[model samples]
Target: MDPTIRNAKLQDIEFVLSGIREIFKIENDIFVYSEKKKLARNAIRDKHIRVAMRGDKPIGFSWFKIGDLTPFGLDYGKWSRKYCWISFVYVLKNYRNKGIGSLLYEDIMRICKRKKVKQIMLDVFTVNKKSARFHERIGFKPLLSIFTMRAR
Candidate 1:
């Protein structure tokens, strides 16, 4: 079945937050929950988040914003005044390879194109081979690598 892509609503807060937590696999501290809640709430309220529903349940979602390049985004291999930054995208584990993720990604691309965005950017950890492969299949190129050094 085709998925219904639409702006997220307040009711989607839990689903959105859970997606973030699961994808990031970060510690579920009170501060983390609060921050996720705030961000999810704001994104939905601003209509910056989209949800793909298959028969009334959300199969996946994507949150995006237009802005200057960041470490988490591609550099387009050239200068651009602005870019479409995809903050997060998540597909339910059971929904893998069902085309739902592509639909959501395509919708985001359409929006960015309509807005004349020069490039679309997002990032996945180097260890996430699955995500990297999926992105490559969808036409994303690596612009840079992010490294972390602990100052102990």
Candidate 2:
């Protein structure tokens, strides 16, 4: 059976946190679970999350936010007033490559169209080639590159 996508609720906090933890593990990044929990709470309250459910269990989710481009010092009002930033899209390890992620992305695209968003952006770690390729396959092109270094 195919999973259905729906907006996440406060009750889904634990599942969202678990997915974020899994992402951190894959990227070898450090994080404070409490902080992530707070962010997830806010995202849910703002209706910025879409969860893919199989029966009663959440198998994947996508989190995103829409904002005006002018705030970033890009004063191209004629070009685009709003943009979307996809923060995360995660599927359970056991259920990957099964098109759940694509379904989650399609849900976001529908929302963006309804909201008149001009562009969508997302970040993928350079080490995560699989994710980058997936995004590419979904028609996301690289606009810029961000690099980070640890200051010793």
Candidate-wise lDDT, in order: 0.83, 0.88
Q: Indicate which candidate wins on TM-score.
A: 2
Model 2 regions more than 4 Å off? 69-80, 149-152
Cα RMSD, model 2: 2.8
Which residue ranges in model 1 land beyond 4 Å of their true spot?
A: 26-31, 69-80, 149-152
TM-scores vs. true structure, each candidate:
0.86, 0.88
Clashes of 2: 0
lDDT of 1 by residue, 66-96 (tens): 8665544544466456788787888988998
Name the lDDT of candidate 2.
0.88
Q: Where is model 2 poorest over a 10-residue stretch in terms of lDDT? A: 70-79
